[model samples]
Target: MSAPANYPIESVENAARVLLMLRDRRDLRVADVAVELGIARSSAHRMLTTLQSQGLLQQKPTRVYAAGPQLVQIGVAVIGATDLRAVARPTLERLRRHLGETVHLIILDGSTIVFLDGVEGTFAIRAAERTGDRAPAHPSAAGKVLLASLTREQLRERYPSSRLRGGTTAAKKSRRMLEDELEIVRSQGHAVNLGESEIGLHALAVPVRDSAGNARAAISVSGPSVRLTEDKLTEHVPVLLQAADQLGASLS
Candidate 1:
């Protein structure tokens, strides 16, 4: 006997796949998606049209379909306050208490670094710019760690082709100059924000890995930039790493 018909789960799943492909590829024509998914050209057209009507996708002047601006807004809304906030809150507080400095939990969701959680340190002078404020992913310590985890192709796909926007010199980000930073983070096992994201701020970030060894987020300590130098980093970096390891171990 055949099972009863239900929601078009297969179609819905395919739609999700198509949405992700559009997100990664950006500016894809119908044929490009059809070839990628191995679906008939007609089926691809229908899917694209359906998604476009729902504001999940858009067809541009070049007739290329991409993730709609509305889709990005929806994604930002859902992803802004994620479950990581709940999972990492106490960890962040404990980490701040141990270091006596501010701790921030940052996650790389798409091209943005989402501030998921944080514990403020009681240093009369501390790194308390804002909570839940997002910065573009390049100069931020958390962004560098996340970039180190991606393959070259994946990196290119996520960022615009021409520009690299790491930030400013005090923050060290410009469009198209991030390769060196990623290399350093990969080799050093962590990333540093040397007043790069902000003039007087210093941050060191360690990767927070899940059971799959994928960096789900980063744990970082941000303090006065004046005191955070290469030599001092030697002492403080380990504390950040240990905190990350404990978080990772709990995930296991």
Candidate 2:
């Protein structure tokens, strides 16, 4: 037996296609959209203009269009509504237990990292609950792991200026510095924060990649710098990588 045929509204489908294209391409010109959709330039312009008017897209000075703030808001809402935290909690708990340090699941939002969930360690003094808190990306292990997943073009689009919002004396202060750090993150498949986000705190993070190999989120273990020593960080990296792999598999 065959399934019944379904109907899709042409304009709505076209708009959704445009959105998907923008997601993969990062930015688009009307001509690019036209070629992708096999639509006339005028029709593509009309669609893009409508999307821009509705705040789903924005045009840059270069005349290329990218996702607008409204789309990002919608994405955040969708991510919030998803069961990603629930899906990741088991692995997070396991890592926390094994490391005896707080384990966190974080996602990137623009140039910042938002803590979605966390598992506290058994230590009398450890990193506190950071769930729902936001922090600058360049200063956190989770943030650097997430940022390392982006292409250079995407990074430039996100940070057009060289100067970055300072988080601490240890934080990367410029795009050049961040790019250099990100290269290390990419090569190592993880990142470490040495009191960059907060004084006397230390963290190590690994990216939880999706099936497409994009860093959908990051898993991190954090504690007081005194106990989470350089040797401890070296010891914890393989364990973190294992947990991240399990979490990514589950997510996929």
Candidate 3:
């Protein structure tokens, strides 16, 4: 038989509840937390500050608490480690077949984009597989799509400086430029890399969102710019979005 329930520690339970609350709501102030938890404002502030100290939460400019990088990283790591690749592989393969280009499953790790898995196209001049590869997030379609999911404060936290760096000259030169591009990605629900990661490469990506409407990963198609021209990349958006939705549903 399974273990029976024991006496619950109230503080620990409250802490867990706070985390759970943050998971659903984007922001919380001390008063909001106190009222919801039926605790004093001082108690709520103490709890929030403690979690912030442990890197489980962050305080925004508006003095509201948001999920911190450590919390997000832990969630992303779990998604990447367990069901993500296995669940996404079939969808990626089907997308590759449909698009006739390399398809990659990517997740954000701070300012980096890690290629968790990929299905390489059969064409002789296709983009290479990038499974287990890490690239600068600012210069890749998959990276930008994932980045666009973050709040403006989160983006600023990730990139504090104006100057940026990447492997290719076409990469966004500053945080301002990157934020602008991310805004476009957010508005369009997709991102594109036209020779931004490499001189002759082009790619397009859409977000694989979880039930909470947060991006857990990105699905991308990449090929040589000669074949995947700007117009062609635009043409692939609808199908890519379909694949992302399929993958997101499976993950959920």
Candidate 4:
């Protein structure tokens, strides 16, 4: 199809605008681009086509667009592949031994949790069968602890009050309940998961703050409640807290 009359010329200035628009969104559809710039759909399509051909934009299965592999490759170089795993390995081992359960180092990526690394205990039965998994912020142990570090405004932006959904059927929490839980988290400087993410899984987590005192990630211990009794969790709290304190001591 031909470019629409409303399309800005294929000049360096307009190309710069194209990059800016893409930079602002993780995903954009053809219609969204047209509406944002007051351009016709055909014009936006042509621009997207050119960008895709040149390896700047990628079209998903649903035809929504995101930054292409080229940009991801560039991002890899710029982000320097920081090895948080290496930095926290010894700490995780110590925490796992103290808790006698699986310990996780999870990073908050956007409103979701990314399990960057995990150390499974020697126990025969464990709750989380996943490593390198991702989960929503409101439900998971590490996720909530990290979420609690953010401000109420940030929580609203990430998990809006209107769309709040409780965790698993066993441990359902409404928006107000979650807000209350967050307040508790802020007060204790730790978060608890009582079969919220999964049935029979009990977890406790503390924020792994940086040298700047900002919670960048969380360290969590999860296990089967039978072995991971309430008393066990209470006993392990100080251990987890101290380990997190050590992890934050170096990274500014």
Candidate 5:
């Protein structure tokens, strides 16, 4: 027998309802599902058992059903897709408007930093838009901020060689030096690049953290060194931090 195309399957609808209810609360009980879906307790129990078998829900010792591993994995993937660039674009644009400097959303990829999106500054002599560009992770402010989130073991894995290679003389020359710089970045909760990527180019970055307080990405503002002096960069930290928090909250 063929099912009607326009009609919703009762079992699927009930299962979706249970999932939605779980979203609003920490867990769900069969009795609660029964009442919410206007179904019998036995029917609710069967539905929950099926969902649990499918790994969408787990039955706890307390007799409650909570999100299972598969559901959690799906939620994490959705957050990743939502956080990448589109979700951060508005924050990037607002930061550029406020600071009048080029703003970039970036992520660390192995030993490289990939620019996911960027907004050009209003000034004529400003950092160029770096969307789709990749650079060594040890030099750029955003790269440093993201790297600071990793453990020492992870850092060593990414940079096995003691000597760090970069485009310019200002870049960190040794892995030990880079590690020390990352420690400072972790302590200060931000990062700075003063002509490390290129002479006379300055940048500042703050991390956009996830629900676990780990950096999922970084937001950076870049401009000429003369305009973004050390003092000016320090002054801009508050604004960048606020924007980073906003982006992080959106993902959460």
Candidate 6:
């Protein structure tokens, strides 16, 4: 095999080196970073300040720096996404085969639902490709299932006001209405979207909970409303629930 070509950019390489140094040491100082990188103190200070601003580094009360909350979040997200995709693909494929509808694995990121992976159905017409796309939480079945997992205080913090955007006429536009819907979702152990996130799309979702019963993700099946009627959706609920349970157990 040919050796990989090296394209080293000086500033980026130095910043990466600094980050690696901080990985083994906490409460780092700019002078320490400078000494380790063999760079000027002023340059080290500038790099540290930039990283701190972006939440990669945090300055302590004692004037030392450590990894910030954003960095921790990024790390967790990376690990979780990798593991989830690997573990959930078989279940997602099985659901698609059983239901003949698009299957999706999703997780909530802040106020939005992110599609981590998906399997297209056998039908010619199917739900839109959702992998790597983010949609507002209020209008998606997967979003509601995931949102219902949060505590009341967390819900309050996430949606403080009643005014919210609607993706379609079926979508909840007010926080009060959304909260009421989420209460039903929690009680029913699932959520439904009938032309809410997109016109003519119907979706049903159930949470994949960990050992502690906290929802870590959601698995959903979606298709055109013409074929995915309320009766069909209700009929498919047990299948989705079973797959979700199996996947959750494996994850736990």
Best by TM-score: 6
**Maximum-lDDT candidate:** 5
Worst 10 residues of 1 by lDDT: 166-175
List where candidate 3 sits over 4 angstroms from the true fold. Answer: 1-80
Worst 10 residues of 5 by lDDT: 75-84
Model 4 poorest ten-residue lDDT run = 73-82
Considering only N, C-alpha and C atoms within 3 Å, which residue pairs clash in candidate 1? 164-175, 164-176, 165-174, 165-175, 166-173, 166-174, 167-173, 168-172, 168-173, 171-196
Candidate 3 Cα lDDT to native: 0.86
TM-scores for candidates 1 onward, in order: 0.65, 0.69, 0.69, 0.66, 0.68, 0.70
lDDT, candidate 6, 67-155, per-residue tens = 66566556547746778777899999999888889999999987878777789998998885456555788899999999998887888
lDDT of 2 by residue, 124-201 (tens): 999986664567888999999998999999888888999998578988889999999999999989999999988899
Error of 4 at 232 (Å): 1.5
User: What is the descending lDDT order?
Assistant: 5, 3, 2, 6, 1, 4
Query: What is candidate 4's TM-score against the reference?
Result: 0.66
Score each candidate by Cα lDDT. 0.75, 0.85, 0.86, 0.75, 0.87, 0.84
Residue 78's lDDT in candidate 4: 53
Comparing 2 and 4 on TM-score, the stronger one: 2
Write down the worst ten-residue block by lDDT for model 6: 67-76
Q: Encode model 4's per-residue lDDT on 1-252: one tens digit a residue.
A: 244457556454455566667544557777887887678889888888888888777777889876665654454345442466668888988877766689988878667776666788868887543434557678877888898888878877876655565468754356567778888889888877878877788888899888778997898999987777778777888989999999888676
* Model 4 regions more than 4 Å off: 1-81
TM-score preference between candidates 2 and 5, better one? 2
lDDT of 5 at 182: 94
